[model samples]
Each structure stands twice: as structure tokens, then as C-alpha cells.
Target: MKGPVSALGINLLGNNVEAAQTVIWTHPKKTEDIGYNFTTTKTITREELNKISKYIDDKDTSANVLAGIATTILTTPLKPYLSISSGIGVTLLTSYRSTNGKLVSDKLKKSTAKSFKVKIAYKYRQTGSNDGYYFIDTIKIS
Candidate 1:
């Protein structure tokens, strides 16, 4: 959480396949305009975590602290054993002020951030044995 007048980004997924995320912020000291908002969605699969593109609603398209995000349709690879994925994000937004909590950030600075993630079940036999996979009960671990 940033502040009372700012918004926090959080994501929740159902069944680990679909995700609902919100990226909204605010300038706490602004008297007339102090809102920022954007939404991001993603889907996790057996092989990758895919970014679902989104845009701001028409009603909020004219906000001061503008929020815009875009992600390529390509996928982020997931680890087989841990079922996890990690990637970085490069964002450009009009940031707010640190002192007065004002939406005075005039530059569209490029901000790069990394995000880390998980997914699925279905079995296929591994052919051409490299190392004999050890088995415990019915589970296989190499």
C-alpha cells in the first residue's frame, strides 16, 4: 500500500488459470484531481504465463496520472518442477510527486520492473530415457 489517496496493485487467480489484477494509484494531496487506474490480466498455462492486454475505460481516459500498460502476446516460460515463471516489465507513466503527493510528474519515464509467478496437470510419458526417473508410489521425480 502506498498511501490513503493512492491505490495498490494486487492480483488474484482462480484455479491458477485466470487472473484479475488492478493497477491504480493516486496523488493524495491533490484537491481537484487525484486518481490513477489501470487493469492487467494474465493466464497461466502448462508452458507459460500469457499477458492479456487491456485499456482504460472511456470514463477514465482523461485522468491526470494516466495509467497505460501493454504486453506482448508472447509467453513467459515456466519452470517444470516448481511451476513458476518470472519476467520483467518496462512501463512508462506520469508518476506523482513524493513530497506533496501531487500528480506533477511531467515526464513519461520508462520504468522497468520484474514480475515472478505458477500451473497444470496432464501426463505424457518421457521417451528416450536419459536418467532413470525415480518413482515414489505413483509420483515421478528425476
Candidate 2:
């Protein structure tokens, strides 16, 4: 296929791609189904944070939301689109205060981790066709 590269945009550790009707699998007699799946997330490390900060040197803070919600979105990326790629995302809770004014703490029962997944797709097109790019298979590649 040669129209545009595509991939499953959002991915979790273990979840269906979309509203699953059913996925049928049939191996062509002459070809091997050489596709596999895996997952990765935006589990941040102190070193990574340091590197990021050091590179930018606090130059721009206008779009620093990623740092705030990295842990939540780390396991997901933008939904499928042109030139598909992987990324991390997160859903952040502003504070540990419960709706009823109860206090919660990260050390007690909160997870501050974020992550997303990367999927590798096999983009292909017919020998002379550029408008029919298709993905024969896709696998997770951290």
C-alpha cells in the first residue's frame, strides 16, 4: 500500500483496538504470518526528567502540560492519523483531595506513573499503486 502509513493510535497494556466485531485470521499457504504484538509505556525515570529539563533549560513553559500528565498519558498516544507514530499520555488529578474534602496521599494509594505505547506497522502498496497503501500487520515496539 502507498497512500498513507497508518497504525492503531491508542494502545493500553491489554485492550482491544476498537469496537471489536471480530478479527478473522487466515494464513496464506505460501506466506508466514510474521506479525507479533507487544507494548511499552511512558514510565519516566529521574534521569530522563533531568535530561529533558537540562535540554530546554526552562525556556518555555507555555506547553508544559505533558510533564504534568505524563504519567497518565504515558500508556496511550494520539489516535490513528496520518504518518502514524507513538507517544505517551496521562490523566492527572489536580490533588489528592477527595470530593468530600478527604485527603489522599500518593504514598498511601495513588499511582503517579504515565505511559503510552508504540506500534510498528508494515505499510505497503501494490507495485504500481500509490493510492492503496495498506498495513498488512502491526506489532508493538517499545
Q: Model 1's lDDT to the true fold?
A: 0.20
Please give the lDDT score for candidate 2.
0.28
**How far in Å is the alpha carbon of 26 misplaced in model 2?**
25
For all candidates in order, the CA lDDT equals 0.20, 0.28
> Each model's TM-score, in the order given?
0.16, 0.20
Across residues 1-142, which tens digit of lDDT does each residue of candidate 1 receive? 1321112223456645532221122222321231121122334321211111111112122222122121221112212111111111111121111111322112211222133221112122222332111111110111
* Candidate that would win on TM-score: 2
C-alpha positional error of residue 116 in candidate 2 after TM-score superposition, expressed in Å: 3.1
Question: How many clashing pairs does model 1 include?
Answer: 0
Q: Residue 125, candidate 1: how far off, in angstroms?
A: 48
Put down candidate 2 lDDT per residue, 2-101, tens digits, no spaces. 3223222233446655321111122221012232322233444444343333323333233354354333222233232222222212111111011112
